[model samples]
Target: MATFYGGVPLVTEPIKTPRYDFVRAPIDQVNTQIKNDLLYSVSNLPVVGQTAAEQRVNKDVARQLLAKVYLRTNEPALAEAQCDAIINSGKYSLVNARYGVKAGSPGDYFSDMFFKGNQRRSQGNKEAIWVLENENPSIIVNGSSGSPQQRRVWGGGYHNINGMIPADSLGGRGLSRIRLNNWVLYKLYPQGDMRNSKYSIHRQHYFNNTASKYNSIKGLPVPYGQDKQYTLSDGTTVNIAKSDTLAKINPYTLKWGQFDPNDVFGFGMWKDFILMRLGETYLLKAEAQVKQGNTSGAAASINVLRTRAQAPQVSASQMTLDFVLDERARELLAEENRREELVRTKTLLQRVAAHNTDGPSQRQIVGLTANNLLLPIPLNEIQLNSQAVLEQNPGY
Candidate 1:
């Protein structure tokens, strides 16, 4: 049964006491870190009325997160109180940028404030509320590489003269491998999608991690309709003799259409990883609404998010927990770490078993108890102070 006061399930004795000093200390450390993070070391330090807006807002978020932890630990009143604190803050907002678009208008912001590159901007920024710092990869990653370099964009190999591979990529004359997953090349493209144009094909299908032939044949722009030597997607023919000499050879040995748009490390590098933006916050609120028995309210909230992705909104007639889970999976792909999320929701292990039936992660987690819900307290905490922690958790 749901613990109404805590808004969480029941917590047993072993989970409450926690066997290891390892367990108790980390919770204290996390709580301390969060309080510090929230207050800018001021709330607990007693420096009054000097708090920054960002620090204030961050503390509120930290409080909300703590509420989630509390709920997991079966502290419903604290969880609800924490949720209400942020909800009542009147500081944060749920905004839909596209709704304001007018005819011939330029006031539209295509951003999710919580996860986009605009979080640091001074004004009109939307979506993300708080985010941890991460660098945009560049010269910071690779040593001895020029100022433009980043780490491992396809293990680099190219020579400026005579078109040879570099010393790094098997003495880099050209790409050491001209390869693409056959599944990707053959199955992924569904027509009219740019991803097909973005992917590559293997050169000779000869070896692992290395291509057998050149791939630039497609990229060399020639007279329109002149690349008749190779099969075209549209089945058009061309006059090879009239085509530019540069157009005849594909630059890739076996890799086709796999060039990086950024041209980092001699190939395309994926630049951005947008995480925990407004979309997720919408989902979170929706989940909370459904949990509270307000189904229509949950559906209405979720629709706002769907409209942005240009995906169809969840119909009230079909709104269900399963649908929400699937929607979460679909929308959060590649952004949120599904592993941790599944565990927290107490749904991942079962879902994995249903899909793979016998996967290792599924089996391992099947035996996990409530204690596994939280992160482990590191071993170092046990050594420093005997009372700092009383015992290690079962898994540890």
Candidate 2:
């Protein structure tokens, strides 16, 4: 890292679009300012006293941010070049084996990164680029704000289960507010792919409590034998026809599980959240290659990720922007913002209308169009400005 501001006075303003001010700058100008700031961070930050791992992580983050901005600006060559540099830098690598405290455990590389203590560079996952750390619940005297809800949003609210207690094996008490759409489970990952395996997604659940009458299956597995018959805690044998009976059909994810022995039902899941990792950089490169009409190069970029997950190799003929987006969904589902990714590719409305099962019935599918692509400028801004009128987006 080097300093570049010898004596120059750089002009700066807030990157966010003005809501209450009249005569706001154009969107492209704001984007240019953001791009310049990110470029400065990548090229001019000092790394004198930082540890080796810290320097590596900082560079990784800076490059990734630049690549993201490049993607937004439709600079495919620049985006692909940035991604290639990160992949070839030797500072980061895909986490292929169990490391850190969970070494020799029964977890795969994909699930290892999401575990409570395995997210940082010092924690042994070289895949991590930028991690948001949460202090341990026991030692922190003052409670934390902005604590992550990775578990609550991604994990199933199986607490809705009748006559069952929340357990670590069941991914704690998930609100399941942001459960996966059917496409993620049925369409994205191929069979036997590690990202969708039982290690990553919890497809089975067993009754764990013993007090209730439905607890006979307590210690018994769900959909066991498919006979749909279970003996009650009081010794009454009942024939349950539906396989999705309570205490049996809780299918969820274990990736965001952070068990706080102290507060089991606490809202905030105190675990380090991975902001960027090497796996997604590969996807970004593949996307840029596809945009540049180099399908073979895109396939090569994507194969690195597919090979690590033991997924079937993709051919150049199968390379498309949609394929790249699907791979992103499979590999970086809960780790990244799906909306932001889709919006970046300009496929948000189309994909939501196509793969979202609930979109049509809920009228969201019908409501989506090119006009609604960009958010409308706030109405208050227009009303407040007496000197000039603030234009709103087309739809709203």
Candidate with the greatest TM-score versus the true structure: 2
Model 2 worst lDDT run, 10 consecutive residues? 1-10
TM-score of 2: 0.84
Q: Which stretches of model 1 miss by more than 4 angstroms?
A: 1-60, 63-67, 70-125, 134-263, 266-276, 316-322, 358-389
TM-score of 1: 0.47
Kindly list the per-residue Cα lDDT of model 2 for residues 11-86, writing each as its tens digit: 3756576443446556566667767887887676533225354424475577888898798779999988889877
Score each candidate by Cα lDDT.
0.40, 0.72
lDDT of 1 by residue, 300-337 (tens): 86777666544555656566555566556544533455
Candidate 1 lDDT at 84 equals 55
Candidate 2 global lDDT: 0.72
